[model samples]
Every structure is written in C-alpha cells, then in structure tokens.
Target: MEEQSVVLVVDDVKTNVLIMRQCLKEMFQVWTADSGEECLRVAKQKPDIILLDVLMPGMDGYQVCRQLKADPETAEIPIIFVTAKDSDDDEQKGLEIGAVDYITKPIRPAIVRARVSTHIQLKQHSDKLKFMALHDQLTGLYNRHFLAERAAQSLSAMVRHQQELSIVMLDLDHFKKINDFNGHHIGDLVLQAVAKLLQDCFRKEDVVARMGGEEFVILMECGLDIAREKTEDVRQQLARLNPMGLEVTGSFGVVTANPQNAELSHLLVLADEAVYKAKADGRNCVVCYQDGAYLTVEHD
Candidate 1:
C-alpha cells in the first residue's frame, strides 16, 4: 500500500493550524509548527509539502523559504504561502523567494487541499522518474551508472575516516546455459530472485548493483573479514537455488581497500581477477584479493 504524503502546517495561530489540519488530514499525514524555527526543526523529518503562513513574530514565511531554498537538504520541499496579505507585490515576493504556490487568507479549504494535492502528485512523479533513471528495469537493482557514482562517494568518506572498504564482483555460473536450457523467461526469474537475495543478504548501508548481464557488484564499508563472511553467506544462498530443475551458483571476486589507497577502477579490476580465480577454482566459491594477492577458501 502506498503511504500518505506528509503536509506540514507552519502558522503562529493555533486556530489556523487546526483548520488546515482538519482540511488536509484526510489526504495527508499532517504535522504542525507554530513558528519558522519549529518549521525548520520539523523539516528534518521531510514533509512532502509545506503550507507556511507569511506573517509571524520571528522569521516570516519569506525568510523561512529563503533559508530552506538555500540549504540543499531542504531545498526541494515545495512551499505555499498562506497569508492575509493578498497584495500583488506580496505574492510576487513569495514566488520569487521559492514558494511554489500562494494562498490568501480567509482560506478556502477546497482550494488549499487541491493545491497541496497537486504539489504532492508532482513530487511523487518526479521522485519516480529519478528512481527509474538510477535503477535497472529487470532486476530492480541500481544500474552501473548509479553504482559507480555512489561507490565513489562511499570510498571518499571511508578514506577520510581511515576505514576499510570492500568491493565484490559476482557472476552467475553458466548463466547463458540457464537461459538457453530453461528458456529466457525462467532465466529472468532467476535474475530477479538473485537480486532480491542480494538485497536481503547485505546491510542497508551497503551499495549493491547489477553491472549488466549476469554480473553484479556490492560495495561494503567493512574490512576483508566481514566482507568474506557476508560473501560466503551469499554464495551458500545462491547454491541453494534450484530454478526450474537446474542448479544455480555464483562465483564471487572480492577486493579490500585501505583509506588512502582505494580507487574504484583498480578495485574493480582486482575483483574481476579474484572472481575469475573463483571460477577457475571450480565455481560456487569466493576468492578475495588482500595483502597483495588473491586468496581462496581451501577445501579439505
């Protein structure tokens, strides 16, 4: 089920807040704040739309709009000025300072609800388009472009904090045969199932993506030990999959980086090498590149 959008009402008058809340509560989850200061504070919770009263004792709506627009974190929130001042100049000023819409005092509940609904709909559409651009259509995992950009950002922070980072490259063993024998339809199901399991296995903070056909990558902000442990779990999970009477397994190549030395290109190359090693060591296993060489789990 889709969650209701949130609307924040920022007004000094308790009566005004109550009226707007009553009007919007059916369509949205409503939150109220008495002053611009409280509005900014509640903003961290990220409301979908804000209905702000222009006239107040401290920090007018225009001032709050200016501050919100200037901060990247809050800049995208749509603001509507609900004020007693219905002058053209007042409306012009509000619009110029980043208020998306304006509503005059002696409020009409229907109009307020309509405008808020429109803005929320637009925001939802915009967010959906952005997600589609960053994610794979088939697997619903992030695409290579988003993965590369996000991995770089994560690597930078890890470098600053002097932490370890691990990159894992995985390829389905004999994926083409699975597609050929089981047919493309069943192969697609296997891909989607694998994507879901990857999401389930990794921590929410980890970045996982599909790097085109039959290959995927995971960027973990953890040392080699933790990365290996998680990768082994994923390997076991994949081995357990029997899609359409065919066994499924994945070969994983993992590489670790220190704060001062992590480069995405280098890590990817090393991970690819390690995964190749896993395949050569007879698939369904993990090979980790650490301390200047590739290391694989030995069988007794």
Candidate 2:
C-alpha cells in the first residue's frame, strides 16, 4: 500500500485547528502548528500540503507563506489559505502571495477535503514529472543531464576547497554482443544489475550516472590513486556478477584533473581517453590518466 500523504494545518485558534484536524485526519496524516513561528519550523519537514490561516499572533500566515515560497526547499509545497478574512481583496492578496486556493471560514468540511484532495493530487503529479526529468527511465540511475548538473557544482567546490576530485568512467566491453546474443530484455537486466552494483560500491556522496548506452561515470572526492583502487574493486565485483548467468566485464578509466584545470568537461575527455586506452590494451582492465599519460593499473 502507498504511504499516506502529510497535511500540515496551521492556525492560531484552537477550535479552528481542531475543526480542520477533524475534517482532514481521516484522509491524511494531519500535523498542526498553533502559530506562524511553529509553522515555519514544521514546514521544514516538507509536508505534502499546507493549510495556513491568514491571521495569527506573532507572524501572520502571509509572512509564513512568503518565507516558505522564498526558500527553494519548501517553495514547491502547495499552500491553501483557510481563514475567516473573507473578501475579494483578501482572496486576491492570498492568491497573489502563492496560495493555491483560498477558503473562507465557517468552513464546510466536505468542500475543504475536496479542494485539498484535488490540490494534493496535482502536487503529486508535478513531483513525479520533476523526478522523471532528472532520472534515467532505464537502470533507474542518474542520467547524463543530472550528471552534468552536479558535475559543475562539485567541481567548483573542489577547486574552492583545494580538495581532490577524480572521475571514473566505465564502458561495457562489446555491449552490442550482449544485446545481440541475449536479446534487449536480457541486456536490460544486465545493465540494471550492474547499476545496482555501482550504487552499492560507491558512497552516498559519490555521483554515479549512466552517460547513455553502455557508458557510466562516477564522480568522487578523492585522488587518482583512491579512485583507481575503488574502480578496480568494482571491476572485480562486476566480473564475478555473471548476472543471469551471462559473463560480463567493463573497462574503466580514472583521472584527477589538475587544480588549475579543474573542469568537468576536460576531465571527462581525459577519462574517456583513458577508457579507450584500456580497451586497446585489453578489455576488463583499469587505466589511469595522469599528466597526459595513460597508465594501465590493472588488467585481466
């Protein structure tokens, strides 16, 4: 069963809070905050939707909504204004401030539930579309787009901190043979299995991504030595996998860019050159690129 969506109800009035809780409790996991200050704190939890009252003691709902919308983390959250301040100007102001819907007080339970349900559904759909845009449909790995997005950010931080960063690029050996021999469906399963192994072998901080068919990249905050060692280990593990009883191996290229030239695009190019060298030397081997020289670290 799917998890229940969370709804945060923010209001200063105890009775109104109780009423909203009663109306929503059965349909959602309802969380309540009695003041705008507490609502801001609770908003960090990222509830699916927020029901905010426009008037409160210290900070008003408008201030809360403005703050939430200002923050990138919480900005996408849907906010619905539920209050007694019922007027054309009040509703217009609330809508202008980013509330998805405005409901006047002396509230009808049924109408509030229906509106909340509709907006929550819309929020879910929007969230899914965003996820699909950033992820690969196959293998469920980060696609080239996400990899490029994170690469620039991480590269910037690496240069700023004077820290080490390395790129490990992998390409399956003779991948077309797998699709030709085992069929695309079995080949897909092999790719997924390898992706899972990559995920398990790398740390949470590492960015592992699929850069189109049969090619993958790993970004890690380590020197060439550590990157090559880790890539070698994954290479051995992948060789042993034999996913679906089909033997498979991948060629790996490891490279650490110079601090003065810490650019992802340039680093990737060197990594690709190293991978090509690995394929030339022999398949299922690890190669490191340093000072424009490719060194074979491991071979099988």
Candidate 3:
C-alpha cells in the first residue's frame, strides 16, 4: 500500500468528538484531539484527512489549518473545517486557508461518512492515475518515461542516503520468432506471463517496468551480490516458463551503483550493454556490468 489514509478529528467538546468517532471508525482509522494544540501534535503522525473544529479554546480551526498548511509534512493532508459557524465568510475563509471541504455541525453521520469516503477514494484514484500515467499499460510495469524519472530519483536518494542501487535490463529471447510462429495473441500471453513471473520474483518495493518491445527494466535497492542473485533468479524462473508449449527464456543485464560516479544514465547504459552482450553470447544467460565492462555467466 502506498499510504494509509487516517481521519483526524479535532474538537474540544467530548460528545461531538464521540459522535464523529462513532461515525468514521468503521471506514477509517480515526484519531482524536481535544484542542488546536493537540491537533498539531497529532498532525505530526500524518493523518490523511483532518476534521477540525472551527471554534477552539485558543487557536481556532483557521489558525490550525494555517499551521498545517505551513508544515511540509502535513501540507498534503486534506483538512475539512467542521463547525457550527455556517456563513459564506466562514466557508470562504476555510477554503482560503486550504481546507479541501467544509461541513457544518449538528453533524450528519451519513454525510460525514460519504464525504470522507469520497475524498479518500478520490485521493487514492488520483495517485493511481499518476502512477499509471508513468507506467506501461500492457505489462503493468513502469514505462520508459517513468524509468528515467524513477532512475533519477533513485540515484539522488542513493547519493543522499549513501545506499547501493542496482539496475537490471531484460529482453525476451527470440521474441520476434514467438510472434511470428505463435501469433501475436500468444506472444501477448507470453509477455503477460513473464511480467507476472518478474513481479513474483522481485520484492514489492522493487520498481519493475516494461521498456517497450519485449524489454523490461528493474530498479532494486541492493548491493552487487543481491542484484546478481535476484537477476539470476528471474532468468532461471523465466527460462522455466514454457507458455502454451511455446519456449520462453530471457536475458538479464545487471549494473550496480559504484562509489565513484553512479549516474542514472551510466547505470542504464551499462545494463543495456550487458543485456545486448547476453544476447550476443547466446541467450538465456545473465551479464553483470562492472567498472565499464560486462561479465557473462555461462549456463551448465
């Protein structure tokens, strides 16, 4: 899961807080705060949505909202100002201060549930769409465009964290022959099957993407040994996949980030070169890219 959506209820009144808790508990993980100060404290926990009371003892909902918007960690969390102060000015002020929606009290349970559910769903779908936009539709893997984006992000994160990053490029063996002999329908099935196998073999956090025309790439947070093992695992698993009686095998090229200079393009080029080298050496093998050269693994 990307991020869990929690609903934070902020109100000084205990009964009103109880009512909201009863209403929203089944649908969301609910957190409660009695005052604006408490709300800020809870906000640090990073709830997905906030149901804040407009009139508090010291800091009002508007001020709470202002503080929330000001903080980078809590800024993305949607806030809904819940209060009895129902005026055009009140609503406008809430909106102006970055409340995504406003709801008036004497609260309706149905409306609260509906609004919360709707907003959470919207956010989830929006995130998914953003994800899909950068990923391949056919293989449900990251597309080439996202490959570059993710690779860049990964490289930066690696630099900041001083962590090892590995890139692997894979190309389907004799994919054109499969298409010609088995027809495009079976070819598609083979591609899908291989994609599923790749997904199954890799960790959930690993970024796997279809790089168009029977080529795919994986970005893993790992050292050289782990990268080599995982790439070999994928290659072996794919080799065993005889889809619809059609022979299916793949070539893998892996490159690990070096301490000296680990640019995203350098990793990509290294992986790509290793993949082609695997093909040239005779398919169904794994190649490791290290210090500007390819190391090929021979099959027994």
Instruction: Indicate which candidate wins on TM-score.
Output: 2
Candidate 2 residues lying further than 4 Å off, grouped into runs, are: none
Per-residue lDDT of candidate 2, residues 176-195 (tens digit): 99999889999999999999
Alpha-carbon RMSD, each predicted model: 2.4, 1.9, 4.3
All candidates: TM-score: 0.90, 0.92, 0.77
TM-score of 3: 0.77
Off by over 4 Å in 1: 1-3, 66-73, 243-246, 259-261
Q: Using alpha carbons, what is the TM-score of model 1?
A: 0.90
Query: How far in Å is the alpha carbon of 93 misplaced in model 1?
Result: 3.9
Q: Estimate candidate 1's alpha-carbon lDDT, on a 0 to 1 scale.
A: 0.91
| Total backbone clashes of candidate 1, pairs 3 or more residues apart or in separate chains | 0
lDDT of each residue in 4-44, candidate 1, tens digit only? 89999999999999999999888889999999999999998
Compared with the true structure, model 2 gives a TM-score of 0.92
User: Where is model 3 more than 4 Å wrong at Cα?
Assistant: 1-12, 17-50, 56-77, 87-93, 108-121, 259-261
For candidate 3, write residues 61-178 as lDDT tens digits: 9999999999998887888989999999999999998998999989999999999888878877887898789978877877888878877888888888998999889999899999
Residue 119 of model 1 has an lDDT of: 91
Clashing pairs in 2: none
How much lDDT does each candidate structure score?
Answer: 0.91, 0.91, 0.88
